[model samples]
Target: MSETHVPARRVVVIGGGISGLAAAHRLVDGGAQVTLLEASGRLGGKLYAGQIAGVAVDLGAESMLARRPEAVNLARAVGLADRLCLPAASAAGLYTRGALRPMPTGHVMGVPGDVAPLAACGVLSDAGLTRIGRDAELPRDELGEDVGIGTYVAARLGREVVDRLVEPLLGGVYAGDAYQISMRAAVPQLYEAARAERSLTEGVRAIQRRAAAGPAAGGPVFMGIDGGVGGLPLAVADAVRAGGGDIRTHAPVRRLARTGSGWSVVTEDGTALTADAVVVALPAPAAASLLAADAPGAAAELGTVEYASMALVTMAFRRAEVAGLPNSRGFLVPSVDGLTIKAATFSSHKWGWVAQGDPELFVLRTSVGRYGDEADLERDDPELVARSLADLHTTVGLTARPVATRVERWDGGLPQYPVGHLDRVARVREQVAGLPGLRVCGAVYDGVGIPACVATAHTAADELLGLLATVPAA
Candidate 1:
């Protein structure tokens, strides 16, 4: 007797960023015939690998949060297990109050479980420290629906805490203003704690205690690849191709429309492609544009999402020319300090691979601009480098001129999660779910971190696989 046969699903993933690449990788693994379409000549989006001064470095994101298994698991699956490494010097500092101070521990996104350590670290003034202690006595804030992380923390711990500690830490992740970023969408764990506990400090303590007792307790907080985190998407793309998936670059998609049985994808050059299912993995704005035709509701919701722009100034200096470098990874400059550079990473100190790649040179990078503060990004690359150097000299006493410099500007690179962002995402998802054989995933929905994007992509792929299983072979 002949046996029943199940056909492989054909899935087309739009966008070549890490999220899109990860989705394509998972779809291929699930026995799907996948095709990944990228708008530009490259993949990786924010996870870009490049060289400066003949030394390899991640021009974009450098590491992934290791506590989540998605990113590390994907890396290992793509043959990067042996290349995983941790920061050589993990301890970081915050440049605040006219000095660089140790980043206080026992805090969740700058909200302290205990203020004593913050005082010891000199991250806050005596008055600021005293203000944080008042959280225990203050009445519970209603926090109706949702609230900005900064607004809630400031209401309880005082504005100084938000400006000095919270702003810079959150800035490093979102490149956004803390006062405008959503507590629920950006930091949901803290948001849950806020809803359950009356005092914000107690809420933070509960979170830390739960984390200590969780599965990932005492593990390395962040992880990097021996080469650079930017290589992740390239490796995933290779894996996808090895699985017989078609990957295309310089193929900007112009239109997406649902067909009678499947979906039709039209490229800007008028190349038409068809697929059994489709994953919309572009950034919010691009995703909105593509979904505007068939999934107008989802597109309208996505249109509300905003983005932030920033630039990274990567520099390499001769080791002999540098003196008195901080004995830590790097320092974050608070916006309140009125510094042009928001944060600086001593790449040579943070990643052993960077230092080993070239012992004679010291490498570092500075991030300039954030959400509403992007005027500095308009300056020429040389001027941006000079401003970064000026701040470095002021903060760390480093006055050496760089041997080589590369400026990477990320315009509308990060999505902003304002209040009601989660609700907006839910609405978009609900609207898209109404259409069969369609799913969406990216930093705009779940999170901006590498792990979160990978996880979201996996979810989209799995959902599409399940939906495809129900359809008859064409």
Candidate 2:
């Protein structure tokens, strides 16, 4: 008997970010013919690699959580395994109380697991420290449905903890206000702990104990590429092409429609691409615009998702000029501190590759702006640099001029996850799932981290592979 040969499934992935690249790589691996469409001239979305003062550095996102296997595994699959590097300096500090204080240990995202360590850090005032202890004495507070991280934590630990400790840490991730961010979506472990335990501090300690016992306990918390984390996307894109996937840049997808047996993706120049499966890997807004016709419910939910804009001011200074700079990784500034710059990373100190790239040049970057607080983003690049310098001077007493500077602004860079965000995501997925050969994945859905984005992309691709397996290939 003669065996039948199945034709390859045609898959189209919208957006050229890490999510899209990852999806394309997985789809190609599944024996599908994939085409990746990127609206921009480049592939990496937030992961951007650039140079200053003849030294290579990351202009966008710099690191990924090492505990998450998705991103690191993807990097290994893309030939970057040998290039992986760990952080040179892991200790980070908080710039508050008119000084740079060490980040407190025994906390889960700024929620104190032990009062001794929290008090030792001194990020919070004496009264704030006392307020955290009260969490153990308070009556059991039910965390019904979903609640804001800031609102729930403040009720137990007071606003001082939320402002001084929580805000800066969460801001580093989402660039969002702590009071409005979703507890379930942002920190699910803490949310579950709060539900089971009355004392928030004990709940946090339980979490810490579990983490210590876990396999990832002694592992590095974060990982960086030898050159820059930004290079991951480029490497993934290269792998996709090597796997015979067609990747296109400057190919802005204008519309998407459900065809009789599959989907049709039309680009800005009116180029139509037919696909047996489609993965919408763009940001929330872009995904909303494309899904409006076929998946209106998902489109509406995506439209409701808000974003935060921020700018990164990268400066390279003479090593001799910045000797007074702190030897630690860097410091985060709380919004309550009334600072223009939110956080600063001592790149040369934090990444060994950066220091090795240029012995005489010291590089660092300062982030500015967040949700509902972006007036400083309107400032010119020079002014942003000056503002960063001023903040650095105030915090570290640095009064040196930079040899090279670059400002990178990301408008609508981060998605805000308010209360009920997980429900919103579920609804979107449910609606999209109804449409055969259609899936969505991005930072706007699972998480803003590189690993989360890659994980979502892999899930989307694997689902499409299964769906396409049942379809009659053309």
Candidate 3:
């Protein structure tokens, strides 16, 4: 390939979220002609930056995993790298057993390395502590090819560990049941180590040691932009256009079909664009519908993928009313608490930039609803906010009235990766591989975080470009 070799491939990307934007950016950056279509009027599906009480903050996804370089790299490529910022506070709390206790250390997603720390944390009862002691003595069981995170962890550490420690952390991320979420897909490193070590505690210790040796182990786990994560998509989309890619909002892809050596993508408005390759970076359901005609197996598998709906209630309160608030970042409520809200983040305390805009005003957000439990979302916005405020008063001693409130609802925000998710992804890829120039990527197929979506998009873009490289130029 020449240094300035321009590929004859015209790639059509369907979807307007970060995944699609990243794919388009990669394709265009690779010197390929591209056309990007989005169903919505604006880009950045789950990431939106908005103002509450004249203070700018992220109304959607606030941060990205810094350990993974895809998101950070994309930010740099789009000229927002210098704007990245870390959280002001790192420690988080767990509201369980009628008190707000410190989260345990030396664990990965509630999987503990030593039982003493868990006992010290007081999140567990005396009975739970007793069970943790007997964990290592338990007989070794047959390890399966794949299993649920709750099933495997509960079996080794007992139900108390899974309920108190594991569930809350996992719930905060997946918004799904621990027993149904895939151990392999959700936390593959720990699950894979569990297969090698007979004792789960020992396995976790080994995993921790390996992490400690790695360069990124003790570094800040997450990062956010100075403005908001929502700005990331817009910057990348701008870069895509600057690279000569055509990006159109409200151009939802209606039909995608193979045309001889290339593919033809039709928009909802009946506009057709023929391209040498096609990348479908969308939700599982939407991707399934578009791929049903050509890759029925993949489509069927995609259709089986489930999702979890959630709502975020952002509230701004007078600073004096929350004077005696906890100094930590936030607190997570386990389902066992029977609380309407699952988690809450103190935005003003967590992000210094959010506070810089208004020091006298305190801002926070509470998340409601999950995979199988969405009754909380059915209530009106006022009802949800009242419940959240009530819980905050009880948990952290807040007696404040909000100056402003914003409620954002995501019907199917998170895709539930059930057991055998990795295997299912493999099958989908195998089926799609049979097609010459078709590919799929997004939160549905790979990881759900911002970095994971970007990484998947880059992979899809590379795959399509590779296929085009093999073809003879027109």
lDDT over C-alpha atoms for residue 194 of model 2: 90
Q: Which residue runs does candidate 1 get wrong by more than 4 Å?
A: 1-6
Worst 10-residue stretch by lDDT in candidate 2?
Answer: 1-10
Question: Please, what is the TM-score per model?
Answer: 0.98, 0.98, 0.98
For candidate 3, write residues 131-238 as lDDT tens digits.
Answer: 777778988767787899999888887888888888889998889999888888999888878888777888889898888899997788999999889999999999
Ranking by lDDT: 2, 1, 3
Worst 10 residues of 3 by lDDT: 1-10
In model 2, the Cα lDDT at residue 393 comes to: 94
lDDT measured at residue 159 in model 2 versus the true structure, 0 to 100: 93
Question: Model 2: runs farther than 4 Å from truth?
Answer: 1-7
Alpha-carbon deviation at 453 in model 3, angstroms? 0.8
lDDT by residue (283-394, candidate 1, tens digit) is 9999999999889999999998889999999999998787579878899988999999999999999999999989999999999989998999999999999999999999
Question: Cα lDDT of model 2 overall?
Answer: 0.92
Per-candidate Cα lDDT values, in order, are 0.92, 0.92, 0.89
Q: Pairs clashing in candidate 3?
A: none
